[model samples]
Target chain A: MPPATVPDATHWRDVQLHVVTGKGGTGKSTVAAALALALASTGRSVLLCEVEGRQGIARMFDVDPLPYEERQIAKGLPATPGATAPDGSPRGPAGTVHALHIDAESALLDYLAMYYRLGRAGRALDKFGVIEFATTIAPGVRDVLLTGKVFEAAKPGRRGKGARQYDAVVLDAPPTGRITQFLNVSDELAGLAKVGPIKSQADLMMTLFRSSRTAVHFVTVLEEMPVQETADGIADLRRTGLPVGGVVVNLTRPDELDAEDLAQVIAGTADPAALAGDLAAAGLEGSPDDLGALAEHLLAQGRDHAERRALEDSQRALVAGYDVPTYELPRLAGGVDLGGLYELAAHLRRQGMA
Target chain B: MTVSSTDPGSAAARSATHRRSSHRVGPLAGTEGPAPYLDLDALLDDRGTGIVVCCGSGGVGKTTTAAALAMRAAERGRKVVVLTIDPARRLAQSMGIEELDNTPRPVTGLDTSAGGSLDAMMLDMKSTFDEVVESQASPEKARAILENPFYVALSSSFAGTQEYMAMEKLGQIHRQAEADGTYDLIVVDTPPSRSALDFLDAPERLSSFLDGRFIKLLLAPAKGPARVMSMGFGLITNALTKVLGAQVLTDLQTFVAAFDTVFGGFQQRAQQTYSLLQDSRTAFVVVAAPERDALREAAYFVERLADDRMPLAGLVVNRAHPHPPVELSAEEALAAAQRLERRRDDAGLHDPELTEGLLRLHADHVRITEREAALRARFAATHPEVPTAVVPALASDVHDLDGLRRVGELLAPG
Candidate 1:
């Protein structure tokens, strides 16, 4: 499959799922929440899920612990005009958007109970600390359960089962480094557990994950390490034949200086005499040391400007190499909050990510 | 390289060299007066230096730095174990291991043509917690703690549990290494969290959580009304009972009751471990990338270490982009690009597009260099006394032992 394009609210409507992963501090949950709100605004019943129980999404939406059940965190805000009801029906002002924090352990227990006809065994295992061992001690099992829970949530169910599930499932997955493993653990475990129900389930999970319906969006800062990790994560996921989606380069500094301007600032070879004249005009007074310090200060400012530009350029270059459509999210001057998430969603919408 | 302590002139010169050198050491230079890079060789020279703790924020290559340093020590025929908490599979892949959990696993491919051995383990957080409870608690107590639903939830769900367990794990590893007399050095990679400073506070946090004042109060017997009136214990106990459902309180009391016997030993050992980290032989390498934020985090970490009197070993800035010196002026490049753009318009000149792209690329490179320089300046200002080093951005992903070796080479003594 071709690399998944970064979805705006519109694209999100077409695609039924979105997965966000990044480094721990890189704001994956925030993006997932925003994407959900954005998609919901476009008249889709969006389900936002956080598998790690970070409660970050709930915090972002100003809600308490989002229970295991999906709750409508926001209706279509004015920003997203087209959200709809559950039945492929038109949404009025009372559109629906839901959020859930997947308790991975609970989900794993539930999955085992439902699928393996091992509910009693699962309960016993949990009592004997086997559940804890499987969830936390085992490397890939948690990832498998988490991914399975998310995948299961994405599909639409029969009418009587529930409000026809979610139109789209947005997963705030594990960090980028472990995301490929998290998403592909079922296959890994399947290899380890051949000729079993788990193996069959893993096969199905892999098939679902590899399908076109699934889209993985990697959130990253425009810095060296996170970007590198994002790239590596993308490459690794691709090797597993998973859909490699777009890169969201978060917290990019604004393009404040152009090349020529940046160069002039850095060279210190710029006509200091002219800059001194400008400073004098601007009513700054100084002795020769003061003037020299002033000039040095100006040069440093110029250098800082150049550095920011370079960082952005490097980030763009790195993202460009992936050949997946990359979206740049500008660094907000203030800390990110609910309003900021909404603003980001709106920006993405404008860029055709629905 | 050795300057005599009595040679005043040489010492002064050496200090000056260190100052100058610190400025040159990536971002950590210049901001702080330069000290030489922490001499691990010297630290371990005594054979008494048992543990080296590498602490810093995330994405700093703390794991790689820890591995490299441990490898360096191990290569010198010192049996070494590098304990890392990085959740990445690459940690095992880097050490050429298929898997590593809470248990210390032998690292393959460390038999450097020099006949030394390296061992590595990824900190399995939950397993470590289980081990702590298993070791410290009586069999019945362990069963109670393990079986309790709240205990299971709190052990995994509580914030800072990982940090507390990490300390416990560190102590375990250190004890094992010390007893074995096989490993000369044990290196630790800390989890990246704001509370990563937890190592400093872990003893108190663990002790308090286990059997501190709150738990002690819970465990106290219900007093008669007259006795309660005398101390006001009843009033406080009533408040706690109300806040935590009676059952919840009972569960906690049961857990703490089981844990009470071991609490003193745990606290004392924790204090000892805390002191152990502060020892001269245990150096703290603050690993960070040269990014503005990471460096800022590093600055805060370094200052915190300094404030706490923790031995600041050195700084390792990893994945630093190497900017090639600018060759062409922006004006000239722009002009060339414009000319190329015209040619492309006229004749679909691929060469012109190439030139234009090259110019833009150069311009981008210049910007990156400036940012890197500023980072270096900021780091220098704040941490001028610390010796620092930069690990250049590697072209390939560090997935295997060879990649780690390359990283080790960069970290090795020049």
Candidate 2:
């Protein structure tokens, strides 16, 4: 089966909260940021949030470390020439991208102040390490706070506020290994606080998390461990009844060789003498042995490339088994800069991820 | 051999005496001002080295590294037990272990002719915590603590519990190994934490929390008179009780009071393991991929190890794109490829086209090697004292004993 099966329309147009997760070093944060840009590009302000305190968004956007407050980071690509948004809506002007670095402690303080009107008392609690305890040592409370903040932003309506602040919220969640535990705040707190504000908050978040409005997207490169983790993470999420979104294949390499050349290289049948003749015709400066050795070197590289291609093919086959709408982002020759990020975002938008 | 080979004053003579020694150590040996090369076999052979901790950011092959090192050491005649926190299923199966309980099962198919043995185990975090509680507390108290809602949460699903439990299991294994001489070398693969330093920080964080004033404050109500508590204390408890609800507060208080008897032992064991890591017998090997972020994390780990005064063995930059010796540079290869591409417009179907593709592939290879070299050079410049081993990227993942042996050879050549 092909790696990425394009859908008829955008798969996640109705998804308000996009929880991006993957194995470490799989570039999930980059994909999350790009996804946020894609969603926001249609003239809808989107909030990109990271809960791990990595400040990955700030680094990708080349800005200062983000304060706890959500602030404007970048402007998404303008609407494509004649293209419409995923929902068949008219494309508007370029939208804004705002980022927030969510830490458990700050979220806890915010929760206390907002829920209980304990602003001064919360500061005192911080002094006595109650805030730290609740945020860190308390089971599931840390996750509750982090997810609580995202829930507040993504929930349809606030108590006093009339409309939603952002069109969508993109969360750079934990790595795949712990993503299930991280998001299953309800189960995690079920044993700890059978009846409390924390328990009720977790239940509320889980309802939103399991609802159609939320989607947990798996970001992976075409490699063994990350792909395996993605598969496992998806299954875990499914078992937990969480909303599963599309799969994003990130940092993909370009095809450098065609089928025939790749076949010859993999079979070790590419003629070195012929390659030497071509090199001689192109250059004008080497003996038979020099060109022969160079050809052999290039052939070894070709063989390695062919082998890697085979490996990637197997991995793609594995990803195909996932049975989800998959997207591929090309690997930037130079590392991901702001321009590269925008390029990725444009790819996502063109692929109907928005 | 370990100390003398790495000495800068005699490095020239050592290189002269042992052909390919410098190249085997690091390719950019002389040009890069002679960064220390990590001698893996030497480290494995050293009787003084009791533990080898492989740590770095995730997906950089820490599990494979630890497994390979453990297997190499065991085959080279050191009784070794590898404690892998999380290994891919294929790798675990390759070691002939299907189940991943806490017990270290004997790894089959080892050479073992040199009087060595290998055992492997996966850490079960909850089981390890239960073992600690079972060992430290009586039946009734242990049952109470285990069934308590707070204890259940902390042991089973807490963020830092895995890290803390890994340390606990390591301490347990090391103590047993010392008592019975069951193993001479213990290779540990840390958890895939968000930050690699989380393991180092987890024990302290968890212990400090267990020993913190807030926990003591929670225990205060049961231990002392109610009137002795300050009004401020009353206010905090009232707020906590209000927010947490009365039942959760009571559950937490009960758990803490019961757990207080065992937390002292937990802190002591954590301290012992912390010192064990800092001990001279232990060696910290920081692993990383040749990518920018992984290398940057390696640098941070190296610095953190230094600041903490942990004994750092060296760095293993895994999956490095080191190409064979080629005189042509990337620029020359690219130029040749461009010329071939232009000529291909007029030429036949097969030879020129194939040659152009080959040249472009060569050019990409050269560029990648150069980029990796630059990154390694930067790491070496900042951490010149660190002995490094660069392992080339394999075409496929290692999933068998033979594959692991190949990796071992690549890691430490004969």
Against the reference, the lDDT scores of all candidates come to 0.63, 0.83
In candidate 1, stretches whose alpha carbon ends up further than 4 angstroms from where it belongs are A5-8, A11-21, A25-347, B1-49, B94-101, B111-115, B211-213, B222-246, B327-335, B345-350
Candidate 2 residue runs with Cα over 4 Å from true position: A80-90, A158-164, B1-34, B226-230, B345-350
lDDT per residue for candidate 2 within A1-354, as digits (tens), equals: 345566434578778899999988889999999999987787878999999877778889999999988889999888768767666778788989999899988888888888999866777788888988888888878888899999998876666434348888999999887888988888887776678787788888889899999989999988898899899999999999988898999877557788888999989888888788888887836889998898898898888888888888889989988888888897765567788799999888877788
User: In candidate 2, what are the lDDT values of residues B1-414, reduced to their tens digit?
Assistant: 011111222322222223324543453443444357788888999999999999999889899999999999999999999999888889999886667589999999889998999999999999899999998899999999999988888887777788888888889999999999999999999988888889898889987788887887777777877565566677787888778888888888899999999888888888999999999999999999988789888999999999999999999988876644656765676678788788776654347777887777766665556556666767777888887877878889888888888889888876
Candidate number achieving the greatest lDDT relative to the actual structure = 2
Question: Could you give candidate 1's per-residue lDDT for residues B296-414 as a string of tens digits?
Answer: 67787888888877788677777654443323333443455565555556442323332344344444434444455456556765666776665665544456666667777666444
Error of 1 at B213 (Å): 4.4
Writing each residue's lDDT as its tens digit, candidate 1 over A1-354 gives 112344433333446668888875566666777777767666667888887654767777788887777687886456325544333466555336788778768877777665555544445455544455446533355677777777777766723345447778888887787677678766555423434455566677788788888889999876656777888889898998888767877766545445666666556555545444433333345665554554454445456556666666766676777877777676553345678787887766556566
User: What is the alpha-carbon lDDT for the whole of candidate 1?
Assistant: 0.63
TM-score of every candidate: 0.59, 0.93
The docking quality of candidate 2, as DockQ, is: 0.51
Error of 2 at A178 (Å): 1.7
Shift in Å, residue A66, candidate 2: 1.4
